[model samples]
Target chain A: MLSMQKVSFRYGKNTDYVLSGVDADFVPGKFYTVFGPSGSGKTTCLSLLGGLDTPTAGEVLLDGISLRQIGGEELRRKHVSYIFQNYMLFPYMSAVQNVVTAIEISGKGGREAKQEAEKVLLSLGIEEKDMYRKVRKLSGGQQQRVAIARSVATGSRYILADEPTGNLDKKNAQMIIDIFLRLVREQEKCLVVVTHSQQVRDASDIRYELTDGQLSLWGEAAEYAEF
Target chain B: MRNFSTIAKRAFRTISGKWKGYALLLLVVAAITLTLYIFFFWLDASARLATQARTSTEACILLQSNDRQQIGSLPQAMREHPAVKGSDTTTLLTASPVNFVNAVSRQDSPFDLPGESDQVLVSAHTDIAMSDAFRTGNASLVEGAFPTGSDPQVVIEDVLAKRNGLQIGDSISMSLSLPGYTEPHQLNLRVCGIYHLQQPIEATYYTSDGTPVYGASPYSSVFVPFDTLAVRFPDALSQDSVCFYLTDFTAISSVLEQFRQLNPDPARYTLSDFTDYRYEQLLQASQAVGRLILAAVWIFIGMELLILFFAILSILRSYYKDAGILIALGERRRCVAAQFLFQILVVGVVAVSVTLVGAFLLTPLLATLASGQIVHTAAETLPGNAVEIGAIENMARLLEEHGGNFAMLYASIAVLSVLVLLGLSSFFLFSHTPTRRLFDKE
Candidate 1:
């Protein structure tokens, strides 16, 4: 479980707040979608959940323990994995090699890591022939599948994806959403995905919206009330 | 091991994929290493040559007699001194044959002897300054070779030979005259060689009345083997002081000081250590040249390092994204640095190895460059007003004998410089910027 308590954040001293008095809870085996318009603090909340940045005030907790106490880099390595919207794959490496690198980084080693990478890519609907191609040569849908494969290959408890389907077409975006749902429903991985797509928001187990640096539920008049 | 291989493989792939940038780096490293090796080798060679020249050669100490009377117990006293007894000393009977050998002065002779009563001087071969002059081309045998052993042979001066019409194999008669003897002893010696002198000779002996009478040197003198003189005219010879030949020239000053304490009378005799003084001057000059070479080498090294530092900074700036990706993948900062260092070391080793081979092939050219300066320094220390090429050749030969010292020094310096440049350049780059910021750049 990942939880935030009265977290506040600003980029620098004297800059306007990107997030203030924000509180939320995330549990395993559920898919949560965070939706907001441009500059609405949605990505800021996702960055915090991924352990990429720390809140200026309050605490972010993981499994009832503070993420800061666990060390941000160690937290990302052991418990959280981040997938960027544009599929940040090493351009020079093939799909399998990219997945293998991620597995090795997560402390896995040897021929077993390579085999596991191959298995993960194959399960994500990447053909054996396409799996050996460089990520740059892959189609947009295939590239998204490889990125999804890389995040899941780590087997971390929580996956924080920032606009994972923002650069994809409707069909490729739906395929990525299917992968996220399968991870939560079958693999019992807690996932927090930030996006502006209504289809993605409706498909998630729960929905939250951000406005004026504050977080609220998608529906109900009291949801947008100040804390 | 697995983790390290992973990073190393990544670095290798990255370097190989973009070989152009790495090729430029390799070229710079090679140029630096080659120039440094040449300078370091020359410095080592010059220093070793200087030291060998300073200490190994023989130094001669000539002792001139104070009076015409027979040498007393002073010769024995000098032999007992620690400095004299510790060295190889050969005492010779040096005298003027003026009273015995009658000759007329030649028109072109430099000496101004009285008319109609001119005489020649004779000395037994002592194997000190005479041999040095012959070896350095200060005097050359114009006819036959130098007389050796106890042969009743003589080497006449060229001017006297020409004036007297004397030729090789001609017997010259000399009547030895002495005090209180009504009969004069006569001896005949065959002329073996005639020599020409290149420098003005300052005659050391005087006439019967204390007036200094200069001789015509090689032009109006005769030289025979010391053993022949001692055997044929034992009563005519005087052995006052001996010439002490020291094996190590650098010890001459100390030995001279020690000898003075033993003798206590500087005016009673004259000591000449010109050979030792000459070597000392040469040693000092060569050392100065060595210092200059080292200074030049270090300045080039500093310039090369600065170029390498900035070049590496620019390359690392390009590598920021790669470094950031590694950091984001949970690699430790040291691991990322190690990966970069491994890449640099690969290039360094290649450059150094190439330089080593290149230096080997260029040894002759490098030796010539080093020898030219060394020869100039060595020649300046010679007795002549100008540096002689013969002396330079002799110095070059000495340097060649000790060439291995230069190679060892060059190897050590090359390895040290490569390691230092790689370590410092990488460490400085990593310490200045945060890896996290690199990862977030689009």
Candidate 2:
């Protein structure tokens, strides 16, 4: 389980807090989504969960150990994976290479890594020919699939995505949502996705809304909630 | 846990993906390398030539005296002086032209002429072979040998021998007026050798009456064994100059002081100043130019390194997104930096290789150009006969032998500069910029 305990964040010393005393728990075999308007710190919440950024206050723990004690790099490399909203695939690498690199960075490489990358990319509906082309040459939906494939190929326990389908069309977004559901059900992985899309929020098993520097369950009072 | 091969493979991909930028960098680095190598070559060749010129040119001190005993004993004294390691002394004497047989004029006469209208003026020396012309290869034996033994053997100039129809076995007769003799002394000398003068040198001598004779051409002179001449005419006036072959020409003042100590009395002996000051000055000027070239090389390297630093910084900035992606994917920061380092190293190796090959191909041409410049400078600054083409050739040969080493040294420096600057720039870019900021568009 990856959990954020009383987390608070501010950009700098004099800035107002973006997240104040917020708490959340992400467990395996569950699909969760955090939805909010602009400036609600939804991406900041996901970044903290994935060890991409350290919380200014409070602790992020993986399986009851503090993220700091586990070391951010080691936690990210061994237990967590991320899918950025912009689909930050290495621009110079092909789709398959991007997936393969993530797997290699996760400490599984060689011929098996290449085979696994191609399998994951193909399962995401990316064609064999497009997998070898640079990601910049791929379409928006294809790039998102490649990004998802990169996260899934690492086989980490926690998959933290910031707007996984923000740029995708309806059909691609639904496919991505279905992939997330299957990852949670069949693979028993923890999926925490931050998005503004109602479709993503409705499809998830658990949902929360971030507003005014507080996190609350959907349809609940606008106050920080501990879960 | 990333291995070197994995990092290297990723680095190779990055390099090949952005080959255009790396290609431009290679070209810039190669141009800088070539320029630096040329400056180094110039400095090395100039220094070597200056040293050759300093060591090869003869530095001498002329010694003159009216006392025969003092002047005659001076050679033995100078030979024993610790300062004169390779020194040689030659006593200059002039033969009277009265009743001197003209070998060239005798060719037209069937009978012997006792008093020929054309007289052969002769200058005798203790060691005629030690003159500058002979030492510097300006004069060579044409048919006969130098007079070495204590015989009345004479070596005449080729021009005189040819004009007089003389051969090696022929004899020449001269009449000398000695101080102790009441009548003129007649002597017959065998023509044992003949020498050709490639360049005529003006010689000065003192007559038996101590009269200074200037503008005497070697073409009209003959070489007789000094012991034979001195023993035959003990009162013969001679002009003697001691040539000191110093181990270090720069310490000439100390050697001159030693020479002065040996012959202190100004009334009996006088020493001429060392005559090769211009050559020494030229060497010093060459050394100054060498130093200037070295300074210029350092400044050029500094400018090139600055350009390289900025270029690397720009590359890292452009690749910020890639770095963010790699870091997000769990690649260590040092591993990412190593990727970029390997990228720059690929280009550095290529540039260094190209520079080595270019330096090899251009060495002869550059050496020739350098030699021509040195020779031209030497000709302008030195006396006409003092400029040695052999010294210039030696400089070129030395440049060839050591030019490759110089190029290798500079190539190493170029590669090392790229590595050091890349490491610093990587640290600056990676250590200061947060991973989140790397994803920012700016």
Candidate 3:
């Protein structure tokens, strides 16, 4: 489980706080979504969750260890995988190579890592023939799948997706959402997706609304489902 | 991974992948390397010639004139000096047109001369035993042996011998005519020895044949016993023709000063610092041309490396985004930097290796080009015979004369060029911030 307790963060002096005194708990086998409009610090919250950035004045605990205690890079490397709105695949590498890079850098199996990466990509509907092509040549939907494949190959417990469907069409967005939910339920992984889509909101086991750096329960039914 | 070989290999791969970016730069570097190689060549050759120059240290002081009368009984003066140990004087006035043939039979003359002017060849004559010792004190021996014993013997110069095929055990006829005798006095003598003495005299003299040879060298004159010369042509010399051989060079000035007080002819007595008299045209000529070529090579190479740097910088900059993405994917910054570093090392190793190989392959051709089809008389100093302790002693003596060294020209150049190239490379390139340049591509 990951929890941020009364976490308050601001960009600079006298500037509006991006995450103002927010508290949240995330657990395995649960799907959570944060609903927010533009400038709602949605991506900012995802960065905090993945330990990409530090809280200005509060504690973000990974299984009772505060984010302050664990180095952000070590925390991200060992415990969380990030999926950006832009896919973030290495442009020059093929889909397989991109995923292989993550596994290699993470110090997992060597050549076996490539086999594992391909298996995951294949499961995510990456065409076997197309997997050898570079990411730049892949369509947006395919690239998004490739990014998801990398996160899965990392094998971390937590998947922190920022604006998971921010640039996708409704059909592709829905397909991505279905993939995240299935990963949480079938893989027994923790899922934290930041989205403004009502469909994503309704599909979450627990939901929170972040507005002006403050988080409030989305509705009592959503919290009840998590418990 | 801490695998330096892998890093090096990967770097080489990257370098190879982008050859066009630095090809011209590489070519320029190669040209410069060739220049450096030639510089080293000259440095080595010059060093060798300089060493050769060092060995031929000058022994005798130059008198103001070739006229021996002004020395004022130097032979008696030197024989009388307390500090003097051993001494000889050979006058190098004008070379005689002497021809030599090995004494095949007693009925035939050992010398052959048809068309030549009669001339006087005056030089230091130790007594037969002393003449043997004096001839031993020289660096080169072209043919024949040193003369010993007073059995009517003389050693012809080797150049004179070569014209008629003379070697050891040859005899030649030579005689000195006194001032009043118009008829040349001839002495049929055993060719006890022949000499190929080298020196720095300016007077040009030759044998019947036209091959160039050192003429009128102080040591190049014919050798005979001091007694024989006096007995044969007593009037040719006087109490005035005395020469001194001072053992301790430091006492030369005082000895000269004493000689001046006794004899009053300034033109008759002048000191010759033989070292100053001799010049190393080969080494000097090499340095002059070598410096120009080597400098051009260096400048050309430095410019090429700079061009390579820029090309490499631009290519790596274009890959900055890929680098950034890799960093974000948890690749260590060092690993990212290592890739680029590997590439540079690879190119450098290849470039230097290629140049070295090329230079070694072309060594003969270059050696020929560097030095035209020139004749080099390779020489060394060895004893005339096992009993000739004078030669062994002279070798050590001449070794000391040259300050105990053999190759000054190339040694100085090798050291200087290496120092300069290393200094230039370190000054221009090491510690340059490669990362900053890559990042600044933004």
On TM-score, the candidate that comes out on top is 2
Once fitted onto the true fold, the runs of candidate 2 whose alpha carbons sit more than 4 angstroms away are A220-227, B65-240, B246-262, B274-310, B374-388, B438-442
Residue B161, model 1: Cα distance from true site in angstroms: 30
Question: Which 10-residue window of candidate 1 chain B scores lowest in summed lDDT?
Answer: B92-101
Candidate order, TM-score descending: 2, 1, 3
Off by over 4 Å in 1: A10-18, A35-47, A125-144, A166-175, A196-203, A219-227, B56-60, B66-267, B276-303, B372-442
Model 3 ranges off by over 4 Å: A10-17, A35-40, A67-69, A195-204, A215-227, B1-61, B64-109, B112-167, B170-173, B178-268, B271-312, B355-442
DockQ of each: 0.17, 0.35, 0.22
**How would you encode candidate 3's per-residue C-alpha lDDT over A30-49 as one tens digit per residue?**
88888777777777777677
User: Candidate 3 chain A: worst 10 consecutive residues by lDDT?
Assistant: A217-226
Best of the two (1, 2) by TM-score: 2
Minimal lDDT window, size 10, model 2 chain B: B93-102
Global Cα lDDT for candidate 3? 0.58
Q: Better model by DockQ, 2 or 3?
A: 2
Displacement of residue A31 (Cα, Å) in model 3 is: 3.4
